[model samples]
Target: MTRRTVRIAMNGVTGRMGYRQHLVRSILAIREQGGLALGGGEVLWPEPVLVGRREHALREIAERHGLTEVATDLDAVLADDSIDIYFDAQVTSAREEALKKAVAAGKHIYTEKPTATDLAGALDLARLATSAGIKHGVVQDKLFLPGLLKLKRLIDGGFFGEILSVRGEFGYWVFEGDWQEAQRPSWNYRSEDGGGIVVDMFPHWEYVLHELFGRVTTVSAHVSTHVPRRWDEQGKPYDATADDSAYGIFQLDGGAVAQINSSWSVRVNRDELVEFQVDGTHGSAVAGLRNCRVQHRSATPKPVWNPDLPVTESFRDQWQQVPDNAEFDNGFKAQWELFLRHIALDEPYHWDLLAGARGVQLAELGLRSHAEGRRLDVPELSL
Candidate 1:
């Protein structure tokens, strides 16, 4: 098959996910394979050109990657007739506006999640992309993860018949930026800049629910800013406007319910970092960020819950390990390749703007539920 090279204009090329994951990891994966296979012709490979804020930083990135073309002006790249796609890894606050502009310029868009801080804005962006007849996608990378994929397979196979509910325990303590220069950027703490676990992570939960259980119809949640203040790399204290943690209940279409506890404050003590436990009438499965285990009804034991009595083991001992299939790379990279393939092969990648909006809507609904102390209906934003 003849390879059709797709030129990609990568915005925010110097940011953390940009230089390391989006550029180095994603583009490198495509390049390493020479080209990705698709239904029609090959997606060829990405020709990623860098665009960012600082010229010096951009130059360093270009030199490090052995690329020469760099642009400080986004408009110039958007205006360039040669570029076929616009890739955005910019700060959350900047993502919506930049993507709107890119869509207007007639370029396909592949951007990071939390597409917008507000539901209305996100919906409008979705409409704009649809009207323009452009390919659009968001980073729902967790779905592509090996562990999560295995869990999805089990659910599809009806390994968990009549799934009762799922409990997700996710998080790890992050270092203060001042002393250790935190791994995540400092801007993530500011609400004005589109920071919050409810907004950032509910998209992940939404997809997981949509995949493992069913679509989420409503959400009731409470959010908190556990650490109200944090110091930046420069040793200057900044008020944290976004919630550092969120506790929410997802009401699925069926009677099934899911409880999600997402936080940045918790310390990891178990063998698995992020664990999702699903219990059903037939069996139960426990999946972590790195592994998954399942136990059938045959192994179920009769036990009585007694507060005074120290109960024996509740879980079965004959739990089987779920085999890992595909080699999982960085989550961001997995989604990147999928998006490019979708564009190249006309493959169905429904995890686009509308799918992304479900997540934003969840956050917006979660915020309203938190503020009003009530359950909020999750509105549908069409693709």
Candidate 2:
């Protein structure tokens, strides 16, 4: 079998998600597994060129992974025609410009959402990438989660006959830097630094709802910063300008309504940090990061409203756990392989830059809906 090496310029390896998920788990894991095999008996090997502002961090990552290529300048790396793809996991504010440069350099693009800080920039990038005839995609990792995969299996199998609605709860309390160093970066709470739950999570919700259930036709949202003040990375006090929580209601094409609450302030009481409960005419299911449980209409329990009496029925036990018939890989790694295959073998990939723009559009409209205190229509987008 012929082996083709695809060098990927991976930016933002210093960040939490970039380093752990993209660099270590996905790309390096692929290398350890002898690269990705294609349909035509060709193996597509991934070689990562680490790019970031900090040379020391990049070098450290290179040494840690036993990889050689490391660069502080993106333009210099992009100048090489051998660098086939540009992958961005940078901050939202810095993504658009870097993506633009990559597109201009005639490199295929893949990035973490929302792809840009706003819808316009996202659409612009989509248009540019399309015009340049370069392949592009955005990270929609949640869709590939084991739980979501089981949920998708049920959906495709008509288990959720005539789906009615979806309820999603996501997030956990992030410690303030004063008492404890925040799990997330301080920039996540600062609006100037492209921080906000709506902008950060609504993109994820958009793709999940769109791909799993139906296209979101309308949205209504309420957003707020529950923690008005928080300590930064340096133990400095600052006003939290971004919304730490967002409650959104979306209307889907099939008349299904989805309500999702995203927050950094709320404490998680559920089984997972993020979970979605989808209800249909014939059954219902609750899906989280790694597990999915379902209750068919035939087996659903009947309960009478009696808050005055102590509840005796074991409601949680009523649902059955969905079996995992197939082994699941890391969601980020899965998407990376697909993208690599798309570039190598012209494989079909629907989650392109345009799909990413749709996610940004949903976020923008959701924010507007919150500001206006009303539901807003979502228009179809085309380039």
Candidate 3:
């Protein structure tokens, strides 16, 4: 079998995720590693052309990554007969239109999550990609995290026995631009531009929950904009229209329950940068960003609860880090490699546009839930 190299034109190459994840992590890092491997020993490399708005910024990025092709126009890149894939890491608001154009030009697409801010638009993109016979993928990188991967192994191996529920604690204090002289991108704090934690992250949890446990049948959520305003990179004050915190609960397909708390306002006290704990009939396992600790039936604790009772520990120890079987790649890079494999080798990749649409559905429902002051049923949009 002849191995084919995938020529890529990366849109939004100047943005944060575009530069870091799609460009540096996926392109340069993959080059550093020779090639990106899919599950069945398939590998793909990017023959990349960087596209962005600013000439100097694009040139700097291209030079840093040793890429020679850099462009300031989308139409020029998309029209290029040589490119095989059009990668998008643009803001959520820009994805739908950009993806539509890419598909129309008959290029495969690998895009960042929340493929579209609206569920209907997301679904349309999926359908359009299918009709065009163009492969499309959305990044769902959390599934490849070492800690989350270990938790998944426990679930699949029946170490957790009959699964009960899962709790997810995600996020930390994003530096406010005022006092810390640091801030997230200006667009992230604005609602009109499709910036909100609910829209940005719920899709992540939606897929993670579906992959680790089961598909979420319904979701009930309350989202809040705790910090009403923030300063931009230039120290200009701006009203924050996006939610800074989100509290959500889901009922899985098989009656299992899960809850997720995502916020940018909290301080990190837990060792886990991201914590996911699954409780089962026979045992329980808690996973942090760096470790997964399991408490089997043999180590079950017997306790009496009292408000003033001092804490006693059993089955408590520093969770050992899951050993690496492969080279460590950041979340986005891992998924990018997988998508490239799916393109190059025709491998099975579950991170499709439909999966991306599911995430948008969850976020849209979460917003509706907050607005109506009631739980919104997760609706399946018919194609």
Candidate 4:
């Protein structure tokens, strides 16, 4: 068996999503599993060096993770020709410049979305990577979620004949710093730090909708700041200028409409933090993070429109739960494995920097729709 090692310089890994999801769950877990199997009695081994601005944090993370290399100097790391890949899990605003440097350094690029704060920056990064002929990708992890995977299976099996609409309900209440500690970082609520629900979540929605249904051609949205002030990590109060919630209606290429609501202020009343309900001619399915419930046209129960009488039927019980027959790995890990294979073997990778640019483009257009009080068309993004 042939064992190939791919050295990766992981930057901004001290952040929450970076530390928990990418570093620990995804990368570390992959190493623990003896890297990603590349078939033909071969495997791709990932050697990641932790990099960050905080030396203490970087060294601590490396030591705790049993990693040998930790560096605060990103320029020095990038200059090392041994590093095949450069990963950025940094805050949204800081991503483009770092990615540009990585591209210039002749390293493959992968990052968490929005890729950049706006459409132009995201597209520029894509162009930069292409010009350098480096393998570049963006995180579109939602498409790999167990629930969505099950939904995709259903769609592929013709279970949902001629899909009509998709409704996504996402988000949970984030406590204000006055009474309780904020679940997310303080930067998430400040505009100067490139914070907003639309920029953060619309990217996920863009990929999910495009992959599951079709390309989103038009969008109408309303975005607003629900909570104006929150306490910071240091227990000091700060003004939150970014929008906390976004309500949007998107029209897909095939005329399917998708309505999504994302908020940090709303409390969870559904089965999960995120859920998507798809209605079609033959059946309807609702999928959460881990589970999917389906009601076929044959199995759907008829309802009466009696307002005076008390409702007796258990409407929710009519849907049948989708069985979990297959094991599902962490979505981030799944995508990471695919990206690693794409790099190691020069395999086909669909979610490149251009797709990420599309996500950023959708978010930018969504915000523009909010500001203009009109529907905006999503122009097709090409290389």
Clashing pairs in 2: none
Which runs of model 1 end up more than 4 angstroms from their true locations? Answer: 39-43, 306-318, 325-330
Candidate No. with top lDDT: 2
Tens-place lDDT per residue, model 1, 42-66, is 4476788889889899889888878
lDDT scores in order? 0.84, 0.94, 0.83, 0.93
lDDT (C-alpha) at residue 26 in model 4: 93
Q: What is the per-residue lDDT of model 2 for residues 276-296, given as tens digits with 9 covering 90 to 100? A: 999999999999999999999
Assess candidate 4 and give its lDDT. 0.93
- Is 1 or 2 the stronger prediction by lDDT? 2
Quote each prediction's TM-score.
0.94, 0.99, 0.93, 0.99
For residues 222-243, could you state the per-residue lDDT of candidate 3 as single tens digits?
9998989889978899999999
**Model 2 worst lDDT run, 10 consecutive residues:** 35-44
- Least lDDT summed over 10 consecutive residues: which range in candidate 3? 314-323
352 in model 1: Cα distance from truth in Å? 1.1
Cα deviation of 2, candidate 4, in Å: 3.6
Residue-level lDDT of model 4, residues 1-383, one tens digit each, is: 78889898999889999999998999999999988999999988899999999999988888898998989889999999899999999988888899999998999998999999889899889988999989988999989899999999999999989999999999999888888898999899998899999999999999999998999999999999989989999999999999999999999999899999999999989999999999999999999998999999999888979899999978888899999889999999999999998998888998999999999999999999999999999999987
Output the lDDT of residue 169, model 4: 98
